[model samples]
Target: MGKVSTFSPAQQAENTSSKIVVALERLSEAFRVLLWQEATQYGLSPIQIQVLTFLLHYPEEKRTVTSLALYFNMTKATISDAVKSLEQKNYLVRKPSETDTRSHSLHLLKEGRAIAKKVEHFAAPLQDAVATSPLKEQGVLLDQLMQLIYQLNQEEVITHQPMCFNCQHYTEKKGNYCTLLKISLKQANLRVDCPSFETRED
Candidate 1:
């Protein structure tokens, strides 16, 4: 004889959802460890490496300490310390903003760029695993992940950074448009950390 277990459909669905949440959490922690391991090789902290990589991808306008603090959900003092350490290592340069003389913008130096390039490949394993899926499946997964990120931001559980879909300047019709810049945006051009991003009020 075999023991039988019974549960309602809703309870079964809840159990499955709980497992999914746990799996996502474990995956997130694994990626963090991978980043930390790569950072150590460059003699940098994880936050410094993150800032360098961010500056490499984003424009100078978004390289301010305040922006980094917001993106990382870190305090200004913590970001300032990381920026100062990077400056002392000659991996980054601080320049006074032309638009705002009181504020400084971060620029990655040659060494910083090199480090960013190296760290960028730290997620190769994850990428390769995702690549094994069909292209359409990959796209579906990305959309699902982005939706979760957007929801978390909306809930204020995470710091709200710039995303094209939620920006006041963004519009969708025949194609994506940036009303501020008056430019047509391609799907690939939708940025996660756009410099001109302004949150659209609901």
Candidate 2:
């Protein structure tokens, strides 16, 4: 019988690390696919459904395409296309921003609101089902996950530069803001430090 050469300690460690990374990626990808499938079965594309759901909670804010693009880490062209399609489908309306002549805002139409409510109602049961774990264990797990997220976000804030230091969208005054947005410039600048920040074309 021929004896096989076993992996060295460093090689074994590398293999273990690589396996962990791949497993994590696979798990993430599976979750994404499952979520996408659920959204699609509800007769809405994932992005459309997300936009609809977001607008329901913050109906007063007529968000611009640029803002949505930045928030979603989506391309300007993709946002523009989605906005156009939604507008054509009568799910949303594009109107000129009252404050900024150069920008436009998205408003969900009445029909869009109705559809969003229906979709959200349908998904609530699934959400509940997925979260119906033992209370004590669930609480502990959630708390730990929240702590992990907070730590990760804190690390991001320390590592990333704030937009206030570079982006023209930021202003120094207590409540100064871009003409297009209702939010304070300081808050907008703070968003740059977010781990999720994505650039948008103005």
Candidate 3:
């Protein structure tokens, strides 16, 4: 072979990791397709829909334009444009941040919350497929995915995921433990996106 490439069928035939990477890429495309379908129905761009959906559940700490930009791997200007559009549509409002006078945070309006709730299920097809798997398998998959996300964050391939693995509250003595809650965690109890996550210092 000339080289080992993910796109090479010959390599993928032998490399399990390459195949998994290809599968993940395909799943990402599915996400985009589902998002676009919902976006068009609501007369919103895909990014705008994502912003509203994220704001609906995440806390105020992660609701600023800079935070959104970093989370989505987009520029601040792009997030600002989307936020402005949402404001004009009365979907959300920008309030002065309690922590930062110069910076403001976003809050979804009544209409915005409604839209986010509706569009959040756009990937129900994907979830429904995974839901058919055995609960034990689901638990294993979740653990594996969480580990992958943690590694990706370590490599700076992704940014600020707010997950349990990198959380200050998390530790593994015999099993997963939450220092903040003083509770032992099962695989099912682990959070991939935890609202209460505080970044652990190295």
Candidate 4:
């Protein structure tokens, strides 16, 4: 039963999990294609566009090359190269880090915000498709996705995720509860990224 391979036609056919994994891989491919199309329009690499998009929403503390490298699971050199290109294109600036004077944090410029807004919609099609699903079905899918992501984060497969399931406030008491928020969370209430997240190592 342990011998399952999503890439193998026979195994994927026999195993529902394998088939779902294959579907996820296809979705990832779709994401890459969308990112490429958006990047090409602005003469930016996919990673550069991603960096701009991320910097647009994230706070300054999380906008450093090191943090970006970790979040994207890419090498520091790769993220730095992307940052350099963005800087050269007048899209962002590097300000000295408030915490570490020797280090720097990314600041998205006005032009970068405009470009990021355009490129960030690269995944709008996927969102629209998901929006078409029944409300309950979307909630179920969100639960499945968040649990999978939480497991991946626990195993260190996904390096950085500030999700509800991994937050200090999270609990399984009477079906998902937030100790800090003092609220019970349903599958639909689960958060993929919560700004108030405080990491809990358990």
TM-score of each: 0.79, 0.55, 0.92, 0.94
Instruction: List model 2 lDDT by residue over 15-69, tens digit each.
Output: 7655554555665676567657757776667777767766676534437777677
Candidate 4: tens digits of C-alpha lDDT, residues 1-202: 5855579999887889898989999999999999999888889999998898899899878889998998898999999999999999999999997678989989988998988888889999999999999988999999999989878887998787888888988989768899888999878889988988998867
On lDDT, the candidate that comes out on top is: 3
Backbone clash pairs for candidate 4 read: none
Give the higher-lDDT candidate: 2 or 4: 4
List, residue by residue over 79-168, the lDDT tens digit for candidate 1: 999999999998899999888899999999998898788887777787788899987776667656766777888899999757877899
Rank by lDDT (best first)? 3, 4, 1, 2
Give stretches of model 3 more than 4 Å off: none
lDDT of each: 0.81, 0.59, 0.90, 0.89
- Give the Å shift of residue 97 in candidate 3: 2.4
Q: Which segments of model 2 are wrong by more than 4 Å?
A: 1-27, 121-126, 134-136, 150-202
lDDT of 1 at 81: 98
Residue pairs with clashing backbones, model 3: none
**Quality of model 1 by C-alpha lDDT:** 0.81
Which residue pairs show collisions in model 1? none
Highest TM-score scorer: 4
Question: Model 4, stretches more than 4 Å misplaced?
Answer: 1-4
Q: State the lDDT of candidate 3 residue by residue for 19-117, as single tens digits.
A: 999999999999999999999999999999889989988888779999899889899999999999999999999999777799998999899998889
